[model samples]
Target: MIAEYADRVWRGESDDSIVDQGMEGKGVKPIVDGVGWWSGFGNVVAFEGSGELALFDTSSPFSAAQLHADVRAWSSAPLTAAFYSHGHIDHVFGTGPFEESRRATIYAHEAVAARFERYVLTSGYNAVINQRQFQAPGLRWPVEYRHPDVTYRDSLTVRQAGVTFDLFHAKGETDDATVAYVPEHRLLLPGDLFIWVTPNCGNPQKVQRYPREWVHALHRMAALDAEIMLPSHGAPIFGRDRIRQALLETAEWLESLVTQTLDLLNAGARLDEIVHTVTPPEHLADRPYLRARYDEPEFVVRNLWRLYGGWYDGNPANLKPAPDAVLATAVADLAGGAARLADAALDALSRGDERLAGHLAEMAALAAPTDAGVHRVRAQVFSTRAANEQSLMAKGVFTWVSSESSAHANRLGAPE
Candidate 1:
C-alpha cells in the first residue's frame, strides 16, 4: 500500500536548471507523519520530535538560509542533531542556522574528516574545477565546514520519542556516503545514492566514486522493503513495491555498468575504448528514474577505469604529452592558419558535428588567442554545443569555454 502523505519532491534535470529557473527557499512537503523535506539547490530532510528536531542535510550556501526558514515553518523545535550525509560542501555547510547552541550533536561517518582535510588542501583547485564544471567563473568553494560531534565507523542508530533512524555507511559517489533508514516509517533517506537520475557514481571532475559498493548499498536498502524513498537531489518515491523496485533496479544499473567496465579494464583495454564500450542494460537505461540527465553511463565507465587503472589511459603519449598550445599550433599550421581552422569549426558546428567542431574550435583558440574573429567563432560553436548537451558536466565545461572566448573578444575590442 502506498503512503498517502508521501513528500512532494522536486526533480530538476540539472542543478543550474533548478537554481536559475528557481527552486530556492522552496517550502517543505510532507513525506509521512513527522517527516518531510525542503527543496532547494539540494534537499534538507527534516524530522520533527516532541520538543526537538533533526535534519539530514542543509542545502548549499546559496539557498541554505531560505531552506532553514522554510523548515522552521513546519517545526519550531530547535535542532537536536544534524546529520551530514557526506562531506560535500553543499550538504554540510548550512548548519549554522540550526545551531541554536553547541549542544546540538552532529552525526556523520568518520571518513568525512579526511575528506574535509583533503578539500581544505585543495580549496583553490576545487574552486577552479567548480567554475569549469558549473560554468560559474566567479564562484568559490566554501572553506568552512561543521565537523561532526558523533561519528560512526560503519552504522549507528538514534531514537527520539520512539522514532528510530538507522544510519548506514556505504560508498557510492564518495567514500563517506551515508544512507538513513527509519524503521517506524519504513522510509529511506539516502542523499545522493538514489537521485532520480542515472546514479552520479561517475563524475568526471571529482575524486574516485565507488560503484560496486554503491550497488551493494542499494541492495541493503532494497532488502528493507522501504515504503517511501527520498533523495537529497530528486523527488520522493512512494509505495513499498515501487520503492523496492526502484532501489533494486538502480542497483542493477550500477552492477551492469561496473561489470562491463571492469571486464574491459581487466582485458587491458584503454580508457577511451572502455568509455565507448561499457553500456548499462537497455531495460535499466529506459527507466525514468535512471535517465542520464546529469551524468551519463559513458562518464561512469571513465571513472571506473580511473579507480582500477591510473591516469595514463594506457596511452604512452599522454604520459608526458605536449602542451595543448603546442599541439593546437601544429594543427592550425597544417590547416593554413587560425582563421581557416575557425571557419572549419563553424562549418562543423553547422553540420551538427560537435565533436569535430569542438576540436577545431579549441585549436583555433590556442593558435590565436588574440584574434577577435577566432574568438567569436569559438564562442558561438561552444555555446551551441553547450545547449545541445544533456549532462551537466559537459554543458558547464562547454559554457565556460564559450564564456571565456566571448570575454576574450570583448577584452580585445575595448579601448586601450
Candidate 2:
C-alpha cells in the first residue's frame, strides 16, 4: 500500500496526503531485504544484520516510543548505532526510547552540537515562530537535545554487522544535514534534504538556508545511483532511475533559483526588483518532487539575497524608516483620513489586487489604531490573502496577521 502511494506521488497523481502520512505514526515496513521504514513526523530507516541494527534518524520525540515499538516488532536485534540525519529535534530525539534497552552510539556532523546550542539559546523564540509557522498555538520548543556521541567534519564510514554505512555532511535545510549511503544495499538516506516537497531552503521564519550548497548536495546524492531512497519526511522511492531523477531535478530547481537571483544581483538590481524579476524554471514546474507546498521559490530568492548580499534592500527610506504607525498616519492625512485609506484598500480588494489591498489595509489599521472597522477590513484582506497562498509558510504568516486584526476587532468592537 505504501509503495503504491509512493508511486502515485512520484507520478504527481497523489495530493498532499503524502506529507500527511509522514506526520502520522505507522508500523515499520520493509523497503528491501534488511531495511525497515517507520513513518512518522520524521521517518526512521533501520538496517538489520547479524542480530544487530543500525538506524538512520531516530525520529521526533512525539513518535519516539512508537518508533521504538514499531522497529522492535520488525526486529529483536539490539541497535548497534544510529546516524542522525540532522540536528532537528524530530530526527535526534527518538534515540532515548531505544537506549532504554541498549546503549547505542550516535553519530552526526560536527555542526550538530552547535545547532543544539543555538536551539537552547533561542528556545522561546523558536517556540513562538513554530507556533506561527505551523499554526500550533502554545507549541513548546525543546531546550535540551541529544548531542552526537561521534562527530565528523565532512564524511565518516562505520560498519555494523557486515553492513557499511557512509555518512556525508552538506548544508541544506540546516547546516548539519547528513546523507547516509549503504553501498551494499544500494540505499540512500537523505534526511530533510529531500522532504518530498520543494527544498525548504526558503523558510521565512527560520535562519538562512544554503540554497547553493543545497544544490551541490543534491547533485552529489544524484550521482550515487541508489536503488532505494528513504527520506526523513516522506515515503520511500524505489528504482535507481526514480531516485536519480528526483535528486537531479530537485537540484536543478534550486540551482535555477540561485542562478537567477545571482544574475539579477550582479546586474545591480535592487532586492525588490530582483524578487519580482527572477522566476523558477517553467519546464520543471510540473515535476512531482518540485512543488512548492511547504516553501515557495520567492522565499528562496530572498534568502539568497541575504546570503550573497547584506540586509540593506536598496531602499534608503527603508534603511532608516519611520515607525509604521507614524508613516501610516502621515499617508492617511494626505489621503484625507484613515477611513479613506480603508476604503481604498477595499477598492484594491475589489480589483483583485490583494497585494495592494494588504498594504493599504495595514496602513489604515495602523493609522487608526482605535478603529475596529479598519481592523475588520484588515482581517478580511489578510484572510483572503492567506486563503490564496500556496505555501504553508506564507499561509501561516498571513493567517496569523489576519487573526491579529480579528482580535483587535473583537476587543475594540466594530463601529455601528
**Which structure among the candidates has the greatest lDDT?**
2
Error of 2 at 385 (Å): 0.9
lDDT string, candidate 2, 151-226, tens digits: 9999999998568988899999999889989999898998998988899988999998999999999999999999
Q: Which ten residues in a row have the lowest lDDT in candidate 2?
A: 15-24
| TM match of model 2 to true structure | 0.96
TM-score of 1: 0.91
Model 2 misplaced regions, further than 4 Å: 16-18
Cα deviation of 406 in candidate 2 (Å)? 1.3
RMSD of each: 3.3, 1.7
Residue lDDT tens for model 1, 176-294: 98888988888889888877777887778888988888999999988988877777775667778888878899899889999988888888888888887777888765566777777
Q: Of the candidates shown, which would achieve the greatest TM-score relative to the real structure?
A: 2
